[model samples]
Target: MSTPVEQAFRDHWGRVLAALIGFLGDFERAEEAAQEAFAIAAERWPRDGAPDHPAAWLLTTGRNRAINRIRRERALAAKLPLLEPPRPQADQPAIPDERLELIFTCCHPALAVEAQVALTLRTLGGLTTEQIARAFLVPEATMAQRLVRAKRKVKAAGIPFRVPEGETLRERLGGVLAVVYLIFNAGYSAPPAQGELAAEAIRLGRALAELLPAEAEAHGLLALMVLHDARHDARVREGELVLLADQDRSLWDAERLAEGRALLERALALGGRGPYVVQAAIAALHAQDPPDWPQLAALYGELARLTGSPVVELNRAIAVAEAEGPAAGLALADALPLERFHYLHATRGELLGRLGRDAEARDAYRRALALVHDDAERRLLERRLAALG
Candidate 1:
């Protein structure tokens, strides 16, 4: 059974950590202080039965711990930066302006975008490096190295860890959006080893939406995460990738689908849009359907217009095939980036098999299967290849 205090601790740590950084004005020290607070909680909380306001208690304890460390080191008169009040001491439970600044600092353009996403997931969302790596489909070692390099760069540059003002905001917004989307993408595309990386991304996106409610892009992202996650349970069979058409719509998460549709509606109403919102609008159509391929096709058309990304075009091609017929999808998919891309080849192979192009489909499936890692995906590709034989 999951303990409430442990749940609260994990859920609230990101925001509390953010607030601490805002107050302390340094990432490394703020993390140390937060760690100390957790240690204290482990020792005292069970006896005290969880303070009425756990977040405040944690924050207060963390800040106090920082002070003790400063004093113990005899830096009391050395003129160090004091912890600025991040949110009122007793009233609102939200983080202060400093937390916002911290977001901006992490979202800084100087940091590689992968590093930005990885760091945000780690520090802001409390995800481990292994989690981040799995989401990105990279090795854990590579992700760890990337994160270490990013931290070193941030320290070396001495980039002020705070939110940016109006003029600079637009320039930084792209990077911020990219990082957020990167997290979402990782969750959306998790390996079989993880229960639901997609769920993790949605959680992070939802948190960001809460922290920045007025930001249309944030809602757009939330909308997208929910829509994708809705299909997760039925997207695969007993160790096989069930193509969308083959998936059992009855198994889709209805509640999450409804919630995602509502978020997309709100996101669309916000109007001041970007690629994520536009892509979400496309996904919203999918979220509402019992696999109505035509509606999905229209959405793909809209999305293709929003961002001419090759990936989007590839998706659009698939949508076109779904709305029309396998022949149409095959032509479109073939013309796109099909080479060295497992999904493209796998898709084309499936289409060709339907078209009675047995030899060609078998070859395509072989190539596609060679590139795929997930067991379920591999099984499906092999099944298709066997069927062709």
Candidate 2:
């Protein structure tokens, strides 16, 4: 179990950092002050007990630290206008939650997509550079350089620390949503130690939906993530990965599943026919006792048309196999240019096994096993390969 201060840091890191950035108007400085405040909290809170309002306390502490650093550096000529006398704790003003603004700033259209994702995960998701690198399968130094270049771009381009307006908001919404979903995916498949990323992404999704109630895709994305997360406990058994069809329904989070369904309804009512909405619908279907494979295949088909993603097409093939037959699905999968994708080979292996083509199935499973990385997934593939004997 985490200490109270540790929990508070997780809960408030983004808010405090966002508040500091708004105050200091510099990402690096804001991040450094937030880290210093958390360091102070880690040292003092255990000895003195946690603050009554930890987020507020962290914000004030971080702001003071930043201000003091500015004064010490004598860069007052440049930052003097932004500085203010630190208020006593008794008279501290209520800090507005500026995480939404911070995320928009991080995800500015002026920045590259990868940079926007790295910056948002760093500032808003509060993930360390190493953690972000692990999630993206990149070297730590590479991720760090990306972050540095991103911050420099933000500074040089003078991207405003505010959400865009009107059509601009709509245009920018896609990138923001993509970043949030990428964070969720990172957490979803992350090692157990890093699973908190998924929860953090959901928290961000909830905030995005609440702050932009009119954005159907935001609600759709939240619904998709929540529905999948509802089955998190059932996705693995012991130390092995569990296929969705074999998962124990009793292990599912009933309340979260209901919430996902409600959110899906809300998105659909808002006339959301976007890719995220379609994917949420598929997740909702998967929660059923026996999923409607035909409906799922149709949804995947629609999603493929919308996104033009081969991954979606691969998923469609799986659904088609369930609804139609192995031959039909295998034909679709074979036509795709995804030979290097392990999941494709795995799916083909399953389809071939069902067709009694043991040799081809073995070859397919071997290909999948060669590309598989996750321990649980690798174990599952190994079991499948052995069963072919």
Candidate 3:
């Protein structure tokens, strides 16, 4: 029921903001100008009708607004030394799509991981501070401060607002991929309240994949997200969480699954077998009916080796349980230092339950319930605990 103008604004806000930041070379000023342009559009669009290229219109308006604001406020003007006048109509493209540069800037290695994720969601994902905070289960005020500090750091450090090249790009690409996947996971794991975030993250991933088609990890990340998102419908049922093995396959999105498979194939074809690619391959295996557990276990072994992540080892334990036995899986799980991760406990509970170690399983489920924050996941752990009784 949303209007075309609303839809356009939602879709193009990041591109407009990215172009503005590239032009203005100041995040605060660029954001303010972009917001002002949107405000004007909110008033004018209903009357003038939406423009053929709404993003282009927004970029032009935002640039003009920044120029006017700079001229009016001397104090503000001093901070920005290189304000260029609005280019003549024929001299410039409608809107320069510099989102890649914007993403790299937001995901700079100098920034903390949390700040990188927050700033990328805000600037490139067009997510509100409140939305980002809610997604991460943090306070709005705290998230706002984090964003402010990150922006100030970018300016103070003079982090270039352009994409890096050669080895530099390779060095920075990991951070960028991590930020994108974090956004996707935030959206994927939360309940319906933040479902749109998952879709937004996927859109960002698709854009990244298209922009850097040669990068195997980019394609791997996109495939991983798409494959995982394909199960969104099956992940929940009648307001309750559904375990993967119990999910109704009919509810899984076929198109998204196919898309993910195709992307995985492409990434593999590129001969890039990074952690993301291996993870995507694991996800693809899971999408199968009676998933190839032996293959999944092998892939998880590769993944754990690639990332040296205890979480991946925990996942590998699950696959090992299926391919071998619950006792074997429990042995592997016990070796991991995953005391703080809720899923580890949950997996341990499931494995112990399968092995008829009900008392230990009950204890694991209780621990998981205490650690888990999500309502659905807590409910699931409680259900498991109740089943033991």
Candidate 4:
């Protein structure tokens, strides 16, 4: 349908605009130029047939439009340079390659964590302001203002518009990967049941992996997302959550599972050790063709040792449940500040359910239900409570 085509066009527009802005060193003018380029495409593509390299066409046309506009504006009125004394015509900033420089500038560490994530989504990730706002639970107006401020800061700070070399490349790449994983996590942890989790996460994950093929952890993270997402259908009942223990294994996406395994295999081959690699290793065990409970348990243990995070501990508890018993998982779950997160109690309830502690399980479910804001999560917890009743 035209909807998919329109969506694709918008996605390309954002990417090309961002790339061209990186090229021109003028964020404000980029969208106008990209739009003009698209207007040409819309007329030409339908009549003369689509071009061979449509994206490249868009980028080239947009840059040309930007240059023409700059020339026209300059001809209209002579303006003094704000940053420096009048420069010789020969002394001008060199335009860097678009895509690489764009990535580096957006990933700059000076921005707040939230701003960095938002900028990447707005630029390379090709997501709309509304989509980004909803994802972060911020008001659309607030997000718009935040983005405006971020762009202004980018211009004012005179952030270098080029990819770094060596040590600098390593540092910038860390922020880049962090943003990708942040987006992935946002999509992955969507209620752990339903409402467009896998599809949304996979969309961004695929983008990240494609954008940075040499970055092994990116592939590993995508594999991890794919592996977990493959279980979406099996993750819940009709509308209620079916714990990992009770999930129907037959319902898992076998094709996705295979893809995830293959991706992890590639990641392991690359041998880039990082948080993502470790997480992928944990996910890899869950996605084993046969689902090796003991191996999966061991992987979680290793992950906990590396991260030492309470969230990881909570996850490790789930893995321990498969290897040892519910009592062990419950004991592990109990040793932390689980009240801050509803999932912690939800998981504890599942382990308690397995331990034949129906009353305690019911209590855990009730507590979790109270903390949950989503309707589906509330319904799931109610169903669990009713089962206990």
Regions of model 4 farther than 4 Å from truth: 2-11, 75-97, 134-137, 188-211, 248-251
Per-model RMSD to reference: 3.2, 3.0, 2.7, 5.3
Q: Which lDDT tens digits does candidate 3 get at residues 1-389?
A: 98766786778988999999998888999999988988998899899898777887888889888888887786664755676666664235466789999999999999999999899889887788998899888999999999999999999999999889999998899889988888788788777788877888888888898888899999999999999999889988888999989999999999999999999999999987998899899999999999999999999999989999999999999999999999989899999998999999999999999989899999899888889998878888888889888
lDDT (Cα, tens digit) per residue for candidate 1, span 1-389: 76656776667777778878767766777888988887788888788777777787788888888878877888877735564433445444543434456667777889877788887877777777897787677999999898888777777898777667676866676677677667666555555665455555666677667767777888888887788788888886775678776788899989988988889888878874677787777776665555567776776767777776666767777787777888998888888855777988888887888888888888888899889987877887887788786
- Number of the top TM-score candidate: 3
The order of the candidates by lDDT, greatest first, is 2, 3, 1, 4
lDDT of each: 0.75, 0.90, 0.89, 0.73
Model 3 residue 179 CA deviation (Å) reads 1.2
| Total clashing pairs in model 2 | 0
| TM-scores for the candidates | 0.86, 0.86, 0.90, 0.82
lDDT of 4 by residue, 190-298 (tens): 6543233345446556765676677787788788888887887887677566666577889999998889888888878888566777787777676555567677767
* lDDT of predicted model 2: 0.90
For model 2, the superposed segments whose C-alpha errors exceed 4 Å read: 1-4, 39-52, 83-93, 112-114, 130-145, 357-360, 366-375
Order of candidate numbers by TM-score, starting with the best: 3, 2, 1, 4
Displacement of residue 241 (Cα, Å) in model 1 is: 1.7
Model 3 gets an lDDT of 0.89
